[model samples]
Target chain A: MRTILSVLLGVIAVTTAPPALAALNVFACEPEWGALVTELGGDKVSVYVATTGRQDPHQIQARPSLIAQARKADLTVCTGAELEIGWMPMVERSAANARIQPGAPGAFEAASHVRLLEIPARLDRAEGDIHASGNPHIQTDPRNILTVAKPLSDKLAELDPANAAYYDNRHADFVHRWTQALQRWQAEAAPLKGVPVAVQHKSWVYFFDWTGLREIVALEPKPGIPPSSGYLAQVLEQVRREPVKMVIRAAYEDPRPSEFLSEQAKIPAVELPFTVGGTDGAGDLFSLYDDTLHRLLEALGHDSSKP
Target chain B: MNTTRFVIAACAAIGALSCPGTGFAASDQELKEIQQQIQALKSEYEEKIKSLEARLEAAEQAARAAEAKAAAAQTGVAAATPPPAPPPPAQPVAPAAAGAFNPAISAVLLGTFGQFSRNPDKARIPGFELGPDAGAGERGFSLNESEVDLAANIDQALYGSLVIALQPDNTVNVEEGYLQTTSLPWGFTVKAGRFFSGIGYLNEQHIHAWDFVDAPLPYRALLNTQYGDDGGQVRWLAPTDWFLEFGGEAFRGDAFPAANGPGHGKGAGSLFVHSGGDIGESSSWLAGLSYLQTRAGDRVTGADVFSGRDHIGIASLVYKWAPQGNPTQRNLILTGEFFHGLEEGTFDGNRFDQWRDGWYLQGVYQFMPRWRIGFRHDELDSDRLAGVFAGGTLDNLGHVPRRNTALLEFDTSEFARFRLQYTRDDADLTTDDEVLLTYNVTYGPHGAHRF
Candidate 1:
């Protein structure tokens, strides 16, 4: 009887201990994405962003330590649409965790949920190197986050089923609060709508779509071509003709071209948080919109809140 | 007191009856006296301390009771309103990767395009021979290479790949078809069917994965096969961070078109040993030794077929220096390799020299994250150059002189590459200019080739 009693005590001691808290491992390829995940996940997830807002996510090296982290990750996510054509292959190989491989249960490609932009008319290898599925940087729009939130909530629930209800509640609360926030920002930005803006790259299509901002000029002669002296002169003429207010740039891209154009045009050079965590206020998944909207609102010379 | 001392001393004397230094018997009377004395002392100390402690506890309880009564009386007056306490701050969540697809199937589309141009001074190359100097124009995109790789994971442990790519010669071909071993025993993996061989570091990496647009000359000069062979390779790794790989391939001779002719291999095989690790905080390297042997039908010698054997060995060292907050804004990498090969051929005709040897060294510097430039120099020599290079009739020929080359290149991404290289042909053959630009793409799923 005593032996049995001792065995039961041993079992009870082993079974009843609280599980040790594991640091949440979060990986964001772009700063905007990182900022958004950070805001939504808050202190619950540990973030390891691959690219700063200042660096291009398209050309990140496949560092060994990054691979080791991805191998053990409870979840692995990336920007799809061939944005990571050079880097993703290495990540898939080195991230040996079965769950994070292409079809693994914990693996995800984030671009699948949102409405893609900049689809190529001729989608062949011979046409020139282009993303076939669509342009991958779709996070510039607040509405895109609305579509991603459902999947984000589902993923968080799947990863931590123990906290499913908590995540679901947080996601619901975030959606409601974000909807309200967007409305206010939209009202403030209403006058800024149809505002003529000059840009270096075609990265602001989503933002332009949402805000109805007019692209008055591009510094580049063609899309993706860095502006030449002649092209810049032409853009200056175009901007002067259209009377632009601001010249915009994606956070990760070089600001030199737009800055030059802004200097010539005598307008403020506005840097937008194209990816999550690209801006100071970019914190959560919903904050992708927050950073972009706040920056645009500020660029348009408006008070941000509670006026 | 003196009489009492005398009595005590007398008792002591009686107790001394139990003598020392001897195994004396125990006296119950003596034991009883000692036990009684001990009990008296214990009782005395215990009673004193116990009384003192009891008094202290009584005083403490009285004070505590008074303090509690006062506090309770105050609380009862305003129990409905609780004092404000600061709320705990929310903790920060850690950053992590994005998205998930169930283990059954996940798909991603990959594509690439590039332009090719050659120096005008170089002789006109056939549209097919030159990388960029195709039949038509300079720096054109019609021949841009693209591919889509569809990948699927089965049973959560086996990964399968299917690839379709626009070949450099302007045709789509099956670039990859193989299964990668994922969940293996102690890092032991077996790859069957067609896959790239782990012959060299650059051999396994895709064209898109290269730091430069065009491949280094050593790969073409040393290893006969262009990319890899369709073979089965089994790799084993030890806990000590060392790896051993062995593979044999049975491929059609036509699969690998050799420069000598549509030959050099009917079947091929290779074996390699690789071990690499970090030397210090930020320094790491891969040290490896490998060998490859192949058999192909030779048609260049005409009626008499020639068979050849290539023995290759290499040792390379690369160092990377990246300092924080650099004014240059560059991740400067200096890498070089020394490769040697001795290839001997056997033919039915009176062949003079069947042995060939060569080596190369190269350096690459990444000026920016996606933009890099590199340079390489190589020399190839053979003791016996009977008929191949010196334009000899059937048997007699001059010594196969060394062919030396200097090349420079630049790269953007895997799928898109741009290069400007000059190969110096110092052999008896024509010293022609050879420049090339190649582009790569993957379709279906963006998975890597076999390592």
Candidate 2:
């Protein structure tokens, strides 16, 4: 009995003890921001990622632990072009943390720093799932990541003044390395320019812009809607007329649609690592681009090695 | 005009005289002709200048009118149509003010086809009295409870949500409507209006989120189809790495287990505490303890009417396991709850004391993506007594009541689900078997369910 009592007491002590305070606590709505925070803040910040690389950011289930983390967070970073419209508002309301509320300094949005794409000419719900603000998937291009990192680092420094110098230095180093990588990737991906591709969804506009790939058509009749038989037939007919090289989809998207198109069009179906940790080779932001370009190059029958 | 011509002719004659004898001087007739020519030229120049000025004035007037018309058209277009799309590079980051004011609205449609070996005559738990709301659903193809939800943030400090359920009989029921504080300090939140009490783990969840077709026996018998009442609640979250929370509620005691009491007072109340944390990368667990108390005034049970105090206690635990990266592909969850209660009251003019308890354990596993299977076991225990009831007993308590259930479910997408469930219940004198097929579809913006 005495031994059991001691064990119970020890367990209680361990659970009740407060965790060691880090310089800053960040709550990230997606894995990409979590990785970005780690890159910029290093050991000065501790991050909690709300959604994994494999989960769609548009919808997520709420958990009490997420609320607990948000309540104590000093900063909340997210893709704020309505990507998290389903759950983020409820989380903010439930957390009751003034620091992370809308219009507060602690709330940082990645989409705010970069120029968005696909702003609709008209606003209407009948057009299927469309973002009024524009496409929220800005992390597909590494250049957008650099654009976001500078402002995010500044926000982190403002939130944690003691680590201002640390954040500034990290931001500089990241920018220098990212610029060099962009130049190299552009040179290596020259063969991919003007390659015609069909996409499962309209989520890769930024990526195609950077690589100079042309989107021939899409599997979905409209954004965020599944394809119908009639739409699939139309796509197949277009494929016959056009020089379609491959079909591409994000790792999180269902692969069946793209696979169906590939079988009919006789093109390779390639799944790109849309974010960090989406695939084995795409462990970080740098490798995510590397793997994306390499797979597209390989699909086009070009050697993936440096020329 | 005559004076101008004379001056011209005189100048011409002076010019002829000054050139002395080298050329012939102008004659009178010649000078007169020169004067007439000068006069014609002067009139032509004046008419041309007048026409040019008039043309310039008309052009300026037309340009001014065109400018006004263009300015009016720009404003008219803005007023008549929606705002033009802003430039993509310079789009504002601020959230859409119009969309923010509109509450999130969603609807869920549920339909089921069921078959039973025996008729379900107000399904009872053998030893416990039931309320009017405790009836099992109808057999054959039936429209089950459909729900419409509306939720919105009222302001910076308050949020509100409402759920209205539509029964198969076309009766509308307000399942929940409450306003909660969002900006309370010290991890404190307060809620007011009608809501389900936080007395048990499963009580707060809606029917659409249930893993099984029907609720556990304890919920039907002890709480009379789950405890929902007009009330107020306060909750506090502890500042620690572990998930620790404490909450309490005070409600009007007009629901089951406390009927015919003062309806407008704080006659019913409960307290609960829960704690949870991740065990590792792929597993998590939560445990909770809850207590409820109510005053019963002429509460009816079977053929007897009782009046006294009742106390109930509940303990629950939930465990979840998933692979390291994704839960959609594979996961398993184990949930269990135990309920115990004591009632001390007068039954049909005779004083009696009774003790009852019930428990259920269930497990659900997603063996593959979009497919899941689940199993549940239920049992109830009650004290057996002879000659304690002046009227009559509902059933012999010598045998313990038990139930078993199995279910298979498939999800077409995040917004739709299909499930088939089979249950064998031995809660009464005879055993009963039931099979149920259900489909649920959701539309519009639905908020995520809490885990």
Candidate 3:
């Protein structure tokens, strides 16, 4: 009986003990949010990013490591226009963490801070996979980042009140640098304004809205559906009639469809780093837009305006 | 002289009363003053009108600018950080008010067309006493049980879900009804009411989430397809870098393996531990061990009845791989489970003691999007009983039951799937070759599946 009692005590001690670090732990669902938290929290917090920039944000599995990280998280940051609907709910339930459940102080949804685009006028499965709340790919626009940053910083401070001032200062600095970068990108991408382009997927709607680019056609027949050769034929005909300058696709997307169109219609196939760490040039949040603009301008056959 | 004076007076009177086309009423200097005054008044009125028009233009421009700003705000195009104490952010567009409080509802539809080389009624594992819910499904075209689920947050701290299975024979069963705590501290969660036991890897998953059309032979013989009962479960997720979980459950034992027992007190209990981690960005694996103990007063299996104490243990392993953590293109999943069972008691008024074991290994490979092929192998062994149990229900018949199955599946989308499966069964003395085509589709808001 004494040995059994000692065994129980040892198990309890091992399970109940917390990590040694004093920093607040955060779990981010996507790479962009991870980068943002790192920039704002700096050394005050430890961030665990669930998915990489090359991963599809819409389709993620609730892997075991993600649940473990969520169990230790003081806060969870996710793009929550049902973007993480496929796996986030499962991870939260499995983690058994009381702090990060929805409607809790530790839960922060970036989509709630910004207005969503492409809200469907009608809801139906016939339209393929649709987000009734709107398109969840909000990170393609830099301005949405500015909007999500404020609420995120406030949430960080609210969860870790000891570093409220520190969080605020870091957030203010990010805003200053981000606003300047946005202006530079705008100036560099002026030639891309109204430049008609065909896209492999609707993943770049936010980017098009920011750069004033017009979408002539999409390679996919519908959202989340891969295009067959027949559908590509139709898309090619449409682009030919509309006479677009280039075809665009994300770095993570399959290159086949866009390449096929580019070959059929004598146009360049441009691949943009959709998020941070998607490419060598997009190493951080700032360079994400810088690399994106440089790629778009390069496709237009113009020299990059900046180093 | 008097006439001339009268005429002059008349002319002066006429001029004062009415001047018609005559240059006799005013002087040139007075005319010039009137013209200059009229020009000055017209210019003053023109200047006032111009100022009013300019003000209207400025007001219109200001209104247009304000509208543009509102449009930008609606789309979240604010270039600067929102001011402190900004207006509460507008929530994602909510469902219609009428359904705001409604629980999430989903329904699963399943149908199967099965063909067999031998009579399915004569099907038996020879050595194993099949549970009531075990054995082959209905022959020919038939609609299997349709499951409807409703889940909602009971409160800030609890979540509740109910699943009802509708059988084709006009019967309904409550498959699962449980309430779970969502706000438990220290990585602990509690579930109460009727629920599937969390002992095995696939026990808690619903039929719609299965990789194959039917449960494996081991599951059928050992767990009666699946083990679920009125129970309370407690699980703890350890705070570690790897996924480690420990759970225990106590059941009233009104369902299978243990039946005809008192309605109160624990008739069966189980303990389980699971650990898992990712190999890298592309590979992940989970392993688990479980033990279940049951005290049966009167257990009925097929036409035979037995009262005994049963001990069962299970071990499961699962591995999954997707290139670069992206499964939309291609992936593979491999799963295996082993079960060991021991029973001792009276069967048909005779003392009986027997041991049984089974194992199954399966792998599914998605070579391309929406297409998958899978293969599974199962084998079961039993210890031949002696004396009164020989040639009885506990008899092994000196045979080792084995089966092989292969399947092909096509998923039209995330919500619908169609599968074709072929199984060669050698469980009985005669081999049975079976073919089945099945369709599974879901409607409404289905919750995300667990890994």
Highest-scoring model, lDDT = 3
Provide per-model DockQ scores.
0.04, 0.30, 0.32
- lDDT by residue (tens digit), candidate 1, B271-325: 7765454334344455566666655455342234545544566555545544321
Q: By how many angstroms RMSD does model 3 differ from the true structure?
A: 20.6
CA-lDDT, candidates in order? 0.55, 0.81, 0.85
The digit string of per-residue lDDT tens for model 2 on B63-99 reads 9999899778888774664332222343456655545
Strongest candidate by DockQ: 3
C-alpha RMSD over true interface residues, each candidate: 12.4, 7.0, 4.7
- Candidate 3 lDDT over residue span A235-259, tens digit each: 9888878899999987777789999
Shift of residue A27 alpha carbon in model 1, Å: 4.3
Better of 1 and 2 by TM-score: 2
| CAPRI quality band, candidate 3 | acceptable
In model 2, the runs with Cα more than 4 Å from the true position are: A1-21, A54-59, A93-96, A118-133, A162-166, A198-202, A216-243, A252-269, A304-307, B1-90, B93-99, B261-266, B301-303, B367-370, B390-396
Better of 1 and 2 by DockQ: 2
Q: Give model 3's TM-score versus the native structure.
A: 0.87
Q: Which of the predicted structures, 2 or 3, would earn the higher lDDT when compared with the native? A: 3
Provide the lDDT at A60 for model 3. Answer: 82
Ranking of candidates on TM-score, top first: 3, 2, 1
